[model samples]
Target: MQEASAINKEHDKPPQITRGFWLTALLILMFIANPLTAFAYFTSPDVIVSVHPKATIGIVYFFGVMSTINFAIAVGIWCWKKWAVYGMYLSVAIAFVINIYLGVGILGALFGLVGGLVIFLTTRNRWQWFN
Candidate 1:
């Protein structure tokens, strides 16, 4: 009877999901940066094009879409959704390619990937908590 009661208690308990310092920091940065950047691109395409001579209004719109997706990914990460990690990886890869296409140079493009690396390192150990 005690064994059965113990199993029942364990089954009834909710799983704990803890976000580490780095993960929390990354999420905060994402939540803040994504929306602001998206807004800038949506509101001021001419300014963005002036800053990046190689970019056009179309490219600015593309970046705005990417930023919106990134914001969604950040929300997913906060909710402990596994697909968010995959989305982050995909977005980083796309950004790297876009940076290179915009003549940002190899080093600059590679630097953009650092966020993805940080996300992978911080969340790799927390895979169990991700649904």
Candidate 2:
């Protein structure tokens, strides 16, 4: 019976898009963005244009804080925290739409769109998992 139990564990269902995939994606994004932003500043700020300057600076700050927080939440969710997973759901959805609305660039929007698709595709069918 003990041997059977161990064999059953080995055959347990595989993770749907294992958390490592998302976390690695977020890390790669963070790495790529830093150098890309700097290079854009030096080489040509015009390559990837967005909306014009605004008075509040709220948009800039919102983008910055969310990126960092999202990274943390990605890591946390990968570790299997329920709250972090929920936050990952809410934050990614809100950020995707808000970024699109706030004039964030296309590549960034693509990342959000893919992230949303990943989450939705993996979880949407699991009705019981949400609660």
Candidate 3:
């Protein structure tokens, strides 16, 4: 009986960990916002170009592509994939650089990274739960 129990324990999966309320909320917001922003960029390039005339259509399209990738990252996060956190950081850094290039100013570019900080804070404690 002891041998059988030991074998069963070895095969048992670990208990599933919940993402908790704040993380869940953050992921949900990311899911909604990223796609809508991507859609807007894709459907109306003029919206961004009108504001930042210095920005080319290529830049606008790049933002749209980044938004799409962000949405995918959010999905990966929802699935508890560790790579998503790194991707989120990378995306934010890219946006910051692009914002600066588009003349958004350093302050505005820094402000854009707030979401990344929030995401890090929300996920920091739950790192062990992520794969």
Candidate 4:
């Protein structure tokens, strides 16, 4: 009876994550790294300024905000929470808008497109884990 119960418990676990989930997970990791990249930028603005000295203090603050937003979104995604998917989409949109104002929106738009796809695939599977 104990053996049968144990087998039942094993079967109750969620199905194995697919290859698409792995790719989506990788993207989530990248999203989580945003803060670290922002920190690096904050510490060494010279590198950025050298490329374009016009980069201002405001830009640093913008990166800081983006870092916080990305971190929160990453956490939500990690927990497979439903709100995280919406948060990810919102962040992508904000990123593109900011980049557009800065005259380099294309990369952010690209990220949004790819990240949207990843989020869709990931959430479709793990969404059941959320409330």
Candidate 5:
């Protein structure tokens, strides 16, 4: 009877995270891209053609700072810090709204969106972490 209970408890544990391990790694990688793209967008206008160079640079700067913050949160999440999970969600949501409003066309933002979802979804069931 005890053995059966132990087996049941083991089965109840969240699926061991093997499936999302790659997604988790990808999310970590996404954090690195945040600053890279932001810098590129900021510098690209200096050497490249754009309808609104100044405006683009300024917008990129804004995203750059935000991305830095998001990247930090990603690291925090990687280390199993609880706030990183939820704080990042809020941060990404804000970034998404701002990026969409500004008409930004960087792929990193999409990765952030998907990566945030992956972390939040994967860890959502683990209440102990939240505490």
Candidate 6:
């Protein structure tokens, strides 16, 4: 009986997308928005100067890279990879620091941190397949 139960468990289908996937998908849209906005800075020096008077082109490039990383995190979570949990935490920490540097406020950063933790913890049982 034990052997039969174990075999049935092994044959069970993987869990479907959890709340984490939905949250990550939402984050993906926000991340894409950042890069799209950065393009305006790259295209027009006037916008860059007006928005960030003391900033250089490097800042715009940096935004592009960060946002791309954010997108990758979202994708990783969607795929249910273990790395996604770490990436989400790391990205939030980085973003929190950057936001403080740029004076953008920490609410979003806090949200990311807390939300990522909740999602990661709640879905941890599904991490059995992860390396």
Best model number under lDDT: 1
The model with the greater lDDT, 5 or 6, is 5
Clashing pairs in 5: none
Which digits, one per residue and each the tens of the lDDT, describe model 1 over residues 1-131? 99999999999998767898999999999999999999999999999899889999999999999999999999999998999999999999999999999999999999999989999998999998889
Q: Sorted by TM-score, highest first, which candidate order results?
A: 1, 3, 4, 5, 6, 2
Query: Per-residue CA lDDT of candidate 4, range 1-131, in tens?
Result: 99999999999997874436564675567675887877876787667656545466778667777777777777777766678778777877776666666655586557656776777766676666665
Candidate 1: regions farther than 4 A off: 1-16
Question: Considering TM-score, which of the candidate structures 1 and 3 is the better prediction for this target?
Answer: 1
Clashing pairs in 1: none
User: lDDT per residue, candidate 6, 58-109, as tens digits?
Assistant: 7666665766676676677666677876877776777667656655557755
How should the candidates be ordered by lDDT, best one leading?
1, 3, 4, 5, 6, 2
Q: Give lDDT per model, in order.
A: 0.94, 0.58, 0.91, 0.70, 0.67, 0.64
Question: How many angstroms is residue 63 displaced in model 1 relative to the true structure, after the best TM-score fit?
Answer: 0.4
lDDT, residue 59, model 2: 48
Question: In the order shown, what is each candidate's alpha-carbon RMSD?
Answer: 3.0, 6.3, 4.0, 4.2, 4.9, 4.6
lDDT by residue (tens digit), candidate 3, 1-131: 99999989988968668887877887898899989999999999998899998898899999999989999999999988989999999999999999999999999999999878987988898899889
> CA lDDT of 103 in candidate 4?
59
Q: Residue-wise lDDT of candidate 2 within 38-65, one digit each (tens)?
A: 4444444333333444313554555556
- Residue pairs whose backbone atoms clash in candidate 2: none
Worst 10 residues of 2 by lDDT: 47-56
lDDT of 4: 0.70
Alpha-carbon runs more than 4 Å astray in model 3: 1-16
Q: Please list the residue runs of candidate 4 whose C-alpha ends up more than 4 Å from where it truly belongs after superposition.
A: 1-20, 49-55, 105-108
On the 0 to 100 scale, the lDDT of residue 17 in model 1 is 71
What's the residue-level lDDT of 48 in candidate 1?
Answer: 87
